[model samples]
Target: MTTSKAFIQPLDRVAIALMLLISLLIGLIIWQGDAVKPRVRTFTWENQQIGSEDVSFTLTFSRPMDTKSVEDNLKIEPPLAGKISWAGRRMVYTLLTPAPYGTNYKVQLQGAKDKFASQESSNRLVQPFTGAFRTRDRAIIYIGVNPEEKGRLILYNLTQEQKKVLTPKDLVVMDFEPFPNGEKILFSARTTNDQDLLSAQLYTVTTGIASQADQEPESPGRVDLVLDNKTYQNLKFDLSPDGETIVIQRGNKSNPGDFGLWVMPTSTESGEKPTAKPLKSQPGGDFMITPDSKAVAVAQGAGAAILPIEGDATKPLDFLPQFGLVQAFSKDGSQAAMVKFNTDYTRDLFLVTNQGTQKPLLKTTGSILNCQFDPSSPTLYCLLTQLVSKEQYIEQPYVVAIDLKTAQQKPLLVLPIAQRNVHMNLSPDGLGLLFDQVVAQEVNAPLSGNTLKTDDGEAIATSDLWLMPLLPIADTTTADIKPEKLPLNGFDPYWLP
Candidate 1:
């Protein structure tokens, strides 16, 4: 009986060992099935609101993430303790309670673990970001007028606290130019009693006091700056970089033809009057003074030239296959930009160097209404318009940046709707843009058509000013940086330093 019992015990022991081995194999398979494969990629958090009680930002992954795994693994801390919600596969976290305004806030995203087995998990990670900004105290002003009065000018404060109106009291403000220091503005006011007679005047505004320098009690402004009525009709003018001289186009009213280029001293004694002397005269012309204030670029008739401000003769810079207009000169007078008018009357932008070199800055795609150079960068900001499918002229305006070095052009902002009589004015620091925006409704055309019309055809005029902050290109990825619009309007906007 003892021998039989001992044999049964040994068999029992062998059976138990086999069962234990099977259980161990099953446990190994279960552990392998639950293992996770991990990966790490850099992500940017955006839309972080500054000066808010609570700050929130959205984390965008390079690729779609596992919603369940992300929700379970991710963690965010007042300044950032908040619940996270799924935003179309992206993770968005927000504070449950509002945080104090103007207080600094930080956000950290810990590493996430996946549910895939047979992959090793990554180390825990954390990324820190800040949210903070000061309250804004600025306003935007928008202005609009009849198409004939396109030369409106505007002036506002840096903080947007104060504003002044400098448009000619009774006459139409034509060809307005701001001084280099931005304290004074020069504009031509035309009095059309019987015929078109124009007088160019300079208005100086300092410490909130507005007065006409040429019309001062002690000193009368120059009335003969252009002198010839026929010449002044088709003439355009610009101020030198130093604001010490004015470059104008001059001709006789009897002739009513393209006169020539003339430079006149902008400043003089109460009794002393400066004379404007012709620099270059040719038909079908335009000219721009270089920012350096040393030279003037001229495009007359079928030829283009560059001449010294005080020179008697001008040198031919470059000859174009087709005639074009010299729109602007670079700051150092090293480059000149031109606009080519096509058969359809659309314009394209090009650059011409001091050595007579020409290069295309913007291609002719749509009708370009206006183009201005950024004072700080080598880019041109232009207003573009195109025809819509409905046969209506839809003016789609954009702020574009043209990289002179690479000849690359990029659109920075797009207007929501068509704006008419639109104008763009950039700040001296390149931080803001003042533009005219017009919203046109199909109200009945007034009998006069000079003002806005109501639905019943009664004329009614309405326009607004828009202020847009020029965002730094480097910070384009940040969604929280929104352009602030100022609330004011006047023609020709000049920003005070």
Candidate 2:
């Protein structure tokens, strides 16, 4: 037994040789100083499609890197302007602005050297890295106005020049808001047999776009009913920025006075249907979900109250008494554009901030139809009407860019006068503005499934979608910019996030 234990097999000799080789390599590495090329240990956004919410990408190296060398040698195709920062072996590239939609981008770093690379004898350099990323395609969703596709939600891929009808012709889509991912749209529609405008029900329809690059895109026009209008009439609705919560204004059918804002999760547990829970707060008007998605800003009484959608709804998180309406909030949620109804029958738009700053932005004699904050810049784009004639009370709708920092207002375009149904949506990249110029139908027919109406609820004969490219506020004037009319005929056109 002792002789058998002393015998070493050929396999054991091979293992011992491998161990000696590895030890020798390790000893050489330590004795001669590390000569191995630095490599990227991790990359946060490799081969990913990012959106507005993605502000930065990170790179972690196997060893500490020269910050200035890495920043100077790094290159991004399509030339994204960004600021580089470092923390030991990690590097972060913060985008100066959201990358434009419908574009593919590449990042390269071949010449960047690690901090300890200079002392090595062999070619002291970092391993060449080539990473790729992309932004979501440029797309828009609108209610189709064509004879064959009337009253249906249509998703038009501007980048691919592809169009898909998202809702069927049997139901007339009243209003819709795209999910943050653009994979689905939340909309309200009424059945073909039901003509009452207030009888619309909430539904979700697939957009034929996959939420992830690896997932296969499903066919569009698959509709799922979310909430029925049998007990309550669902009015205006808003989807939170995170796409996790939905706030809808509802009014009880039996009790005319029973009305308030309702909150619900966009998803539910497995085998559980989504349900809406009434928010225990005062009745609100023109409600919207805050940027955080945890609270709802509702126009209650004479103030805009920020009420938690979840626990303790009765206690408001905040209240701004000066603002009668919240037009829009900045993506950062630090500021908001609010409206105040003046005693002299005027509307004043103010820039209200979370830092207890209420700065006046604009004053209008007519209505402040809508306003959106530019996600990339210190600007607020608004669609408003001006009282051109007192006798006729003629109001002309126009688009204007207001610089939040300098308080400079630039009139972009003056739309057709008295087009109250006109709607405007700012592009996610802050490079374009979309607005619909609608032609109202003279016939006052009863509401039907085939009948189309503007977002204002007025019957419309035809509508044209227009896209206007925006310039930096300081670079040029409105005279140089032009509004390009799209080939689609639809109202309430909105950019798919």
Candidate 3:
């Protein structure tokens, strides 16, 4: 009756409540030891858009997982075969083949227990997890063949059936190469009023397509000049696989004899325009950027030289004195399809590797126009011209797929002997091949404005683009696959990366 009323301050009451909560948590832990469920904490590719180069994805778990249990329980919709590896609580799945373009995929994980989960426990498995990712849309870029859209760079989405013109009518797009992201195209074009093809300058045009999921589509036909033709005449240009550098064959306007390869950045710091600089090396022919994007493979005097474009380009990084031309490099840069000029005028296609192994794949009596390595398979697709008629000396262009392991060759398409101006390209997904047959027109008038020609300089009368669906290397019935004539009217067709 005499004791004063006990008071509990706000701070004291909060501390008492926290202690009780801690005590309760400890009691629950003691009663249910190691019973907590595991879960997928994060998925690297979840709800994202990926390309053919994205060959692996990762999953991180809330707790260390049983590697075998997780591997056995993991499921991928559409059934992609891959290898699994583990690093602590993270799991990585590397695809044996590239995922097809314009496809959505799902990954699911369940019924997989954690590292410490007891076999006797009923609920020790990982919580059900589902994630999804999508590949980019299949698209092609070509200089339009129709009169209305002729000489303009055109982008057509094969998956969406959407088309957009990327260049203006006044600018006749002479040649173009897409950036790795497909958001822009590096092209050489001249004014419709200017008749000189050599007067063309280097430029980049927006495709009005988004390269990534988070990026908004750019406005189409937004043109930016990269190299002006005022001082140097830009001839042929090659964009690096990494899309950071551009190597352009340029000749001085004042001194036409002064010509060499000029290296420039695809983009520059804000407010500063990109400028081209001399490569500080001997002039060479038929140059291409190496797959690693660090060197240039050029046909020197009697051999092919790999010159480092990063620094000290004068010193050849590696020289293959036997090979006269570097046709194509595998996507990984580990192997290359090189051309060796023979004394008898025949060319030998050799498989050259970085491991110092050079194996002759085939010998070609005709020209090796182009060759591309399959991204997902050990195959090389090549376009060559065979001398069909010894009397007429006619060269017939044909495409062949060569198995790298066995050196077996499969003829894909044989073009008309007259279609020597034909151009071919392989799809990034390795599922299709694109080529065009051109009907050259006799131009009585002097070569002038907006009069497009085949790359071989024949005036273009018309062109038809064809697509050949490719079969998996495991398939025995590849002969049954036929070429489909696309509805598009274009030439020099190329697949968007």
**TM-score winner among the candidates?**
3
The residue-level lDDT of candidate 1 at 263 comes to 74
TM-score of each: 0.56, 0.94, 0.95
RMSD of each: 20.6, 2.9, 2.4
Superposed by TM-score, candidate 3 places the C-alpha of residue 124 at a distance from the truth, in angstroms, of: 1.2
Number of residue pairs clashing in candidate 1, backbone atoms closer than 3 angstroms, sequence gap of 3 or more or interchain: 30
Which number leads on lDDT? 3
Clashes of 3: 0
Per-residue lDDT over 1-497 for candidate 1, one digit per residue giving the tens place of the 0 to 100 score: 35534346788999999999999988998976533223323333322323221245566653345566566655443333467787554667675433332233344444443333214354322233232222222222222254543323343444545654444324444455655533455665444222233343433322232222222222212222323343344357778878888877766656655466667887677757666766663443556776777766666565555567765444543355454667656545677667777777566678877676778777554556566665556666666665443366555666666777777766666776555456677654456677655555445643331233222232325455666666544455523445555454343344432
Q: Please say which candidate is ahead in TM-score: 2 or 3.
A: 3
Candidate 1 positional error at 490, Å: 3.0
lDDT accuracy of residue 105 in candidate 3: 94
Task: Report the alpha-carbon TM-score of model 2 versus the true structure.
Answer: 0.94
The C-alpha stretches of model 1 lying farther than 4 A from their native spots are 1-154, 191-234, 268-271, 314-323, 341-348, 355-357, 387-395, 416-420, 439-460, 478-483
Model 2 per-residue lDDT at 154: 89
lDDT for model 1 comes to 0.52
